[model samples]
Target: MTFISLRNVTTLYSLENVSLDIAEGELIVLLGFTGAGKSTLLNVVAGLTEYQGEVYFNQQNMNGIPTERRDVGYLLQDIYLFPHLNTFDNIAFGLRANSCPADEITEKVEAILALLHIGHLKKRYPKDLSGGEKQRVGLARSLVMEPKILLLDEPLASLDPATARNIRKEFKALHNRLNLTTLYVTHDFTEARELADRIVVIINGELKQSGSAQDIFCQPAPEIQEFIAAAN
Candidate 1:
């Protein structure tokens, strides 16, 4: 049931001795303060950065695999929609790059737009859409690829409070509907508590603790307890 596994994974500078397993269809949130190697860990899983140790996706070693071939859907904190492409083309970009047939690309794009409830925004350009709409379109672009694992790096970080809350609900709903195995990275404890089936805490390049939300909230490590106190 382990869809993604990292064994003693270390990045060049940020991450060290990190190991974890994410189950199939499970949603885990990586919780940490800024510069705590959360993004570096995600980059390692997505094959966007070089790391020492083992990374496995669906039981296959992923050492030398390229990012695109790793079958991962990665959404970074910064939305990187192509300014030249409208919403539909932006979502269809990956399919087109993979040389999917024209009809198939259209079908997939339409389906994702509907699934994300952005069907009406298809004709709008990035400049014309609101922040939430743009974020959803970026999500549609990543989800349309049908990746084995979805890596979301603070996808809600930029939204207003109400919009972020609404999008969080939508993300949970989509995950259930699609049975997505997702690794969501965030620094917000409330967001982590709301979205994670399990929570992994990292600090200064090492994993401190990981457990269910109740366990983490009730019996966190000293460092995590300190963090919680400081945040409050």
Candidate 2:
């Protein structure tokens, strides 16, 4: 089934007319240059920004829905874990805000912690955790909400190369294990190549091309050819 659909969606100033459909459990990557509206597209679907057209989740129109009610999880480049909250509390903040039962919150939080292999850092504050550890916690916090769609905007960008590569593998495994429908945005071609099941390339606020990684690399558009030439 088409899990998320955007029909002629355009974010104010940032994203031009864009339409895309993502199927359930597909890990699609948005690959573009630094200012190509990749993040803008994700924000539109998350309802964090206003757009001109329609966004549908499970065939339901989401024009008037708010971000918190969208059943989407977003993890940005910066780890915004509250400085004062311990790991467990930070992960549970959303559930608490929604008045989920304390016992249910505990169950969900614990399950996510274990799933992300961050159970050992449950008591550590964000200040005490390393960069990679903090990112893992941020991911755990997002997954704890049991979101149907996960939107990640360069979640591994700040890590060292080795750490980033390892996390990419972990993220791929997690997506498969959880059957997550994910839209991951990144400017790095290597990262997109490594993680994407299908890649969509956006340039100058336009979707230039989209296909399997092999197809995209092997038979790129003229613009994409230029991009690859410049990158190499």
Candidate 3:
């Protein structure tokens, strides 16, 4: 069933009238170059920006819902961890903000750390961690919240090729295990092909096409063909 819907969504400057529907437990990848408004679209669903249109989650209108109430786990490209906080504290920040019991926070944080294989890094600060370690820690912070929806904005963009590939595999595995309804934004065709249940192509804020990987590659729209050609 449709779990998330955007109808005639438009931003003040970046996004245009765009509509898309995402099903429960589906991973829809938004593929586009930088400044394509992919991130803005994510912020719209996240309720972090103003827009003109309708956004619904699980059949409920999300127009006026606050960001925290939306139950969204947003992982951005930067993945900045607090300089003074250890991995454990950084991951536990959200739980603490919600006034969760200390023991419960510890339990959740530890579980997430183990899930992300960052348990060993819990005592280390962000300054001591490598790129991949930081990324895992950042991911742990989001997954620990157990949000109903996960929004990723070029999460692996800053990593090296090998690290990006590894993290990509982990993301796919996590999605399958958690059955998360995820909207992943990326410019990488390979990443979209590997992870997306469906791929939606956005160009200059407009959705040009959307379909399975095979459909997109076999009978691409003119815009998609051009994008692919440009990539090649």
Using lDDT as the measure, the top candidate is 3
Model 3 misplacement above 4 A: none
Clash totals for all candidate models: 0, 0, 0
TM-score of 2: 0.97
User: lDDT per prediction?
Assistant: 0.92, 0.91, 0.93
Report the candidate with higher lDDT, 1 versus 2.
1
Predicted structure 3, TM vs. truth: 0.98
Candidate 1 versus the native: TM-score? 0.98
TM-score of each: 0.98, 0.97, 0.98
Model 2 lDDT tens row, 1-232: 8999989988778788889999999999998878789999989989988889999999999999999899999998796999999999999999999999999999999999988899999999999999899989999989999899999998888889998998889999999999999999987889989999899998888888889999889999999998778767
Candidate 1 weakest lDDT stretch, 10 residues: 223-232
Candidates 1 and 2 compared: the better one by TM-score is 1
